[model samples]
Target: MFYAVIPAGGSGTRLWPLSRAGHPKFLHTLTGTSASLLQATVDRLGALADPASTYVVTGVAHVASVARQLPTLPDANILVEPSPRDSCAAIGLAAAIISLREPSALMGSFAADHLVRDTDAFVEAVRAAMGGAEAGLLMTVGITPTHPETGYGYLRCGDAVGDGPVSRVAEFTEKPPYDVAVSYVESGRYFWNASMFIWRVDVFLGELSRQQPELYAGLMRIAQAWDGPERERVLGEVWCTLPKISVDYAVMEGAAAAGLVGTVPGDFGWNDVGDFNTLGDILERDERGNVVIEAGDGPVSKPQVELLDSERTVVVPRSGRLVSAVGVHDLIIVDTPDALLVCPRNRAQDVKKLVDGLKERGTSYI
Candidate 1:
């Protein structure tokens, strides 16, 4: 069985007011389902990874809440970072620890907040990717593009590497311009980089040592002391010294250049749930195409909202007060105890701008 590592370290600023610094978007159930995104992610991978083999890498601020959400998780499985160093350090640390325990084990590092609707299909894709990883290739599950989505990074796919259901990752491209995204979709050669990666722990650590020598060295030191009494001291000394970089920049892109990277084409329904508009699309809506999300304590099955002639809108009622909207179309209304967010659906991705402004003002609402 493959070992699973979940990196849950983002504050999710795009979905502010509802997603705060202490309580992030992963903690909230954006979907109508009872499980949060983090819980859903763990459950989705349960068929492949047992509780002991699964590890969650999170920040000091979220460790308690993460443990509370996942009662079955072992205490040792929760790896806490001293600070927010980026994805590279978080994932590299997990890889290093897993390597010491079982060098040849297949370690699949998945995001803690991504939504995968078809758990069966996701597991099948991971199994397919495992074949490539077993063959000494770094594997990633590439999501099939549905439209000209410019918000996500794109992966350029090439010819098949081997007989297994995996292809060589030709190139890794960041979010491009509208025309470039359109061309990518029209050419049918690109897949959205959802950041779900699978590979042998030893193989991945070797690649990391090759690409990010300094970062890898630091993580190894921390990992060696992880099980001992010097765990916290080593982590404190080495973590902050490591460079803050993403795995894409530190490893994957370089490995793809060396022809050591492959991917499985995953067409399973996936959603990043980055912003309110994306959440609005996933949730249930009214007859007039208005989605009212009920949040906070108490039995909030139905949202206390009154939408009049509102079409294609999203309303989040989190403050236990009745929210009334009239003739407001394509708008997002999020009401919290201390802050209220009002933005058009087209500007949903720009909600982080408001958070930025509030942060500059040193307000607690952010």
Candidate 2:
């Protein structure tokens, strides 16, 4: 059986005002669907894994919201972290807990706030990656790059693994310079790192021990007490102590260097939705190429936005007040109850700067 592990720990600083510390992007429906991103992620996994076998690792603040969103998930399956400790700690702890029950079970970790236009292809890709997992190799899903994207990480594909569709991961590259990104796309051997991982519980724990021994030891202790009365005490004591690092840097990079990592290249129309510009690109646009997203889950109607002579603009109306745009071109305006963000559409990725400025002021908006 395969187990699904979801890491919903990011605040999505780039998507701030809409995504805050108290309410992350995973809980919101950036997509046109009625289901929130987190729910959509779990729903997409239903084709391969059941709700009982799925585990969501989220922060203490959002645990209640996660429960309300996913009622079918057992309370025990919702592993709560006392604080945000990066992806390695969150996903490692989930793997540790699953190892206690079924050491050899194949477990997959996917982010909670990504947009997948084709669920069918995604399921197939995960199934393809499973072969590598069964062979004791760390498996990751790689998206066929359509363009030279300097924002996302890249995974260089090596030789095929055991007559399977999966390829050995030659090297893992972080967000590269523009020139380097162009070369990667021209080579055709590089694929966008989708941050989707599948591996046996035992194999993953073993790799964690080999790469991040301190974190592995802490997770094992917490996992041992997970089902007992000391669950809260042990988690509280150990979770914060684990180093703050991403699984890509702490585990996958080292494993790839050791030739124990494999990837399945797929073109499943994947979008990380990390920034407003990317979100605007995926969402529907108006006649003049304007995208307006209304806040709250309300009936569909004409948006409360009035745009005049606006082209390629993205506006988010959440304050329940009509927003008027005049002579704006390629601009992003996000109106919230407590904060308002206005910047050029090209600067969407820099929205995190506004979030950081607010945080520096000790503002309550974050």
Candidate 3:
């Protein structure tokens, strides 16, 4: 059986103001659609797997929101993390729980906040990964890079693994400098590491046991108590003790070290949609290169009002709000009810610094 595990514990800090503590980025309707990023992820999974086979791994704090957003998903499918441990523990817990029921299940681990344009190509790429997983290979989809993006990690492709659409993983590189990223792209040897992994439950568990023994032991303790009457209580206690390491650092990187998994090319028009700037780039833009999202009430007044000689600038005004820009070129103006973000078009990735400063000030309201 094919199952999907959506990890929804990340607090998309980069898209602040619109993305707050109470409401994460996954819950935001940035695409001008009624559906949220989490709901969109679940919908994407529905196209490939049964709704019954899909699971959402999220923090206990987000349980109610996740449940409210996806009422159709089975209640048991919502795997609640007691605390924000990290992706490694979150995915390990999901694998353990799902494996308890379906030993031979092929589970696909995905981030809950990505923006994918081509659903059909995504499904096809996943099918190829499933085929590779069936052959005992921990398969990860490597996105064909459209640019020399330093924000994402790259996966170097090695030899061809099988006749199917999988290839041996050459190596994994974390986010590198601009020169390295450029060299990787120019060499035509690497793809953006999308972090979308597929493998059998036991295969991942075995790798965890081999590499992260301490984490595996902790997971075993929780797995042993997963079905008990004290399941929730036990989970709460155990979650706080798990380390805050990512799955890539703990497992996938280790798998590459042990020569167990392979990297496969995927061309699904994938974008992680990490920030508001990226969201603008992924969606349609006007002739002025503006991307707007209107929510809450009626259409935003002056949605595309031009000011003094500002060409090729993007202005996104919150509904029921009036926003005007003047003397700005190639800029992004995101005006929300609570906060307004104005930045140069090319410096969108640096918005995270503002979030860091806000966090430092203990402004929990975002």
Please tell me which predicted candidate would have the highest lDDT against the true structure: 2
Residues 144-238 of candidate 3: C-alpha lDDT, one tens digit per residue: 88888888988888878778779877677889899999999999989899989999999999998988888888887888788889787777777
TM-score of each: 0.97, 0.97, 0.94
- Please state every model's RMSD to the true fold in angstroms: 1.4, 1.3, 2.0
Badly placed stretches (over 4 Å) of model 3 are 296-309
Better of 2 and 3 by TM-score: 2
Rank all candidate structures by their lDDT, best first, as comma-separated numbers: 2, 1, 3
Instruction: Show model 1 residue runs off by greater than 4 Å.
Output: 296-298, 301-303
RMSD of model 3 against the true structure: 2.0
lDDT of each: 0.90, 0.91, 0.82
Which runs of model 2 end up more than 4 angstroms from their true locations? 300-303
**What's the distance in Å from true for residue 307, model 3?**
5.9
Q: Which residue pairs does candidate 3 place in steric collision?
A: none
Residue 117, candidate 1: C-alpha displacement in angstroms = 1.1
Q: How many pairs of residues in model 2 come into backbone collision?
A: 0
